[model samples]
Target: MRQTCVLLLFIVLTSCEYFNIKKTSPEAILKEELQTFNWNDVDEYPSFSECDSLTVKADKKVCFQQVLTTHISGFLQNEIIVVTKDISDTLVLNFQVSETGQLKLIDAKINALTKEEIPNIESLLYESLDSIPKIFPAIKRGQQVKTAFELPIIIKVN
Candidate 1:
């Protein structure tokens, strides 16, 4: 019981900081204005989905894996700037996008990555993700659309 209380306290404290940072309610992302098909009309966009249930650690891995195999190829097709070989790196970032659609990177940690690595990964990823269609079909009546949504994004070079 004491453990539960501790967990509850922890959640209360970090809820706004970790997850809700976006302030983008499930409805907003699903809305027609943002993606055309709210979570109700989800058509499976490969990456990104209603996967908040995942732990921060798991979410990080899922996002990285999804982007690499699913979206990296598309991004690489574009202009290649950095010639750096794949160097393993991990980052934990807190971000929020305003209603105006401005994406922001609040905080990030380069576990084992260098300063140059961060930007390279960021630039390449942002470019590649561009080809991705950001939209999800709205759900209705407790139905979870079995779509392969993008998890959190993480880049690693070995």
Candidate 2:
């Protein structure tokens, strides 16, 4: 009878999940999730009022870029830019949209020839960005996030 009781106790202890499975701590679980998460992607792209209606993420991004380019091009067209020689170059404008929807110009990469032709091109680009309408910041995991962009603008003047 004593041997039977000892055998029963052993079976019960071995079958219990507390003995067979290790408990996961909250910190360990969080760390594992963080390791698997992708940090470079955003749930939604930054947009203007006109782009807010789009449902697809890629469509929304394209619409945002189109609107921004139109606004900047329109602004630049209104200004008088005269060049002595034919000039064709691309200007890379690096800008950031803050979490609060504020636009800031980080850098303007203009070629030497373009800069020589237009002395105030940087300021012109900044002013054009400043004139853009209200922007909606990008979203990541249900939280608003800042995003940076590099837009290449072609400058062609004959």
Candidate 3:
């Protein structure tokens, strides 16, 4: 009888472990799903209306950037205030494209010195970005995804 009880306990303990091993807790499953997500890069960059014709990914990115730079530069040239001092600084524009393919300007920043000297830079950048039409969102794994970009514009004051 003692031997029978020992054998049954052993079977119960081993089977319990086996059953436990087969089942994943909700937390564990969530963690595993999250781990599979890639954050570094997307399969396709965001698309601009002007960039639709480009077949290559690199070309698309280049065309989109060129169009953006042109728009920003043109707007600045037309609307920017004339500063008396010779100024050279980099303006960083951080923006995002939503999954719904709408562009949102997150932030615009220049060097502290530039900010002090050129108060209009931020507003001009924001206004120019606002003028841009809807942009297609980035794609990853066959699904539209929100994507962010940091564009640095070199500004020189004459």
Candidate 4:
């Protein structure tokens, strides 16, 4: 009787998942998921109404950039900017689209020569952005998210 009881207890303990398998807590699983998540990438890029029809991710991005460039170019072309020397440089515009679909300029990196030639370039860029159509914020994990972008604007004058 003693031998049989010991064998039964041993078998019961071995067959029970509580003793054999390791159980994970919800907090631990959540922490692991967060560690593996990529925060820098968004599932969908921000878009303008005109770009909303595009299906491909790359195409949508290209369309958004093209529209933005066009708007800024149009605004700048209307201004009479006279330069003494030929100026050919690129300006990097850093901006952000908020989750609420509002656009804001973070910074503008203009070369010394460009700034000397066009003192109001920053204001002009802001005005151009103001003229752009309403934008849709980026989407990540099915939630609207803010996104930052750096756009290069080429300034070429004869």
Predicted candidate 2 versus true structure: per-residue lDDT over 1-158, tens digit per residue: 99999999999988896667788999999999999988888999999999888999999989988888888888988999998888888888888999999988898898998889898888899889877999999999999999999877787888
The number of clashing residue pairs in each candidate reads 20, 0, 0, 0
RMSD of each: 20.0, 2.1, 5.1, 2.4
Alpha-carbon error at 109 in model 2, in Å? 1.1
TM-score of each: 0.32, 0.89, 0.74, 0.88
Give candidate 4's error at residue 112 in angstroms.
0.4
The number of the candidate with the highest lDDT is 4
lDDT of 4 by residue, 61-114 (tens): 899888888888888889889888898998899989999989898999999988
Shift in Å, residue 12, candidate 4:
3.3
C-alpha lDDT (0 to 100) for residue 16 of candidate 1 = 72
lDDT by candidate, in order shown: 0.47, 0.89, 0.82, 0.90
lDDT score for candidate 3 against the true structure: 0.82
Any residue pairs clashing in model 2, and if so which? Answer: none
Ranking by lDDT: 4, 2, 3, 1
lDDT of 1 by residue, 68-155 (tens): 4455544544454453667554445444333222334454455544556545655555555456544323233444334322234445
